[model samples]
Target: MNKFLEQALLFDFYGELLTDHQKEIYEQFALEDLSLSEIAEMKGISRQGVHDLVKRCQKTLEGYEMKLHLVEKFLSVKEKVSKIDDTLAEWECEKNDPEEMVKRIRKIADAIIEEL
Candidate 1:
């Protein structure tokens, strides 16, 4: 996964655990695409302070992921759904037996739901 996307996912999964101040700074840096200097200026802190806070936020979010694995599970489910979609598309192209295809799709869907 892309680094930014990975960070975004981590944040999405665990951002609420952060303090409001931490969340605001992280959102500015990660989501709003602000430079460290820009965030420092906006937050009335030194650039290094903003950098340290952002790093701490990243570590905290990653720690949550390591313990909870919510993001990992979410990504796994997403991949499985994509596979189900691809299987259906293949069935459509092949024009195979409808009943058998339905059974296969149902099995895949069931597995996905079970994982959830």
Candidate 2:
């Protein structure tokens, strides 16, 4: 994944666990695309301080993902759903046998249930 996108995903999944200050700085730097110097000046902190806070927030968010795997599970489930959609579209276009399509859908559904 793109670095910014990964950061955004981690933040989306675990940002609530961060402190208010951390959230503000992270939102400015990562989400709002502010420069470190700009964030520093706005927050009345040194540029280095702003940078460190953003890095700390990143580490904290990644740690949460490592332990809980909520983001991982969400992505997996989303992919499975997309595959199911693709199968349905293919069935519609090709007019494949209904019994085979049912079996395929059941298999995917079973895997999703197992994961949950």
Candidate 3:
């Protein structure tokens, strides 16, 4: 994934684990795209303080992602589903071997169940 999307996903997944104040500031600045000065003015903090808080929150979110690998697991499941879809499409085009297609479908179902 691209850097921005990766960061966004990590922020979304790990953000709830943050402190309430951290969540508020992070949501406003990171997700809402507020400028530091604007956030500082809203929160009654210095711009430098807001900047530092955002940095700390970012580091904390990254730490969770690195340690837990929740995002990695989710991405792996998504890739498997995509591969299954491609295989089904190929089977449909080739119009050959219902047995193999059934087996593939079964495997996909099993994999999705395991993911769930």
lDDT of 1: 0.91
Which runs in model 2 stand beyond 4 Å of their true positions? none
Better of 1 and 3 by lDDT: 1
Per-prediction TM-score: 0.91, 0.93, 0.78
The sequence of per-residue lDDT tens digits that candidate 2 reaches over residues 1-85 is 7989888888898999999999989988888999999999999999999989998999899999999999899899989999999
> In candidate 2, what residue range of length 10 has the lowest lDDT sum?
1-10
**True-structure Cα RMSD, model 3:** 2.5
TM-score of 1: 0.91
Candidate 1, residues 58-81: lDDT per residue as tens digits?
Answer: 999999998989999999889888
- The best candidate by TM-score is 2
RMSD of each: 1.3, 1.1, 2.5
The worst-scoring run of ten residues by lDDT in candidate 3 lies at: 1-10
lDDT (CA) for every model shown?
0.91, 0.93, 0.88
* Model 2: lDDT to the true structure: 0.93
lDDT of 3 by residue, 72-104 (tens): 988888888898888889998999998998898
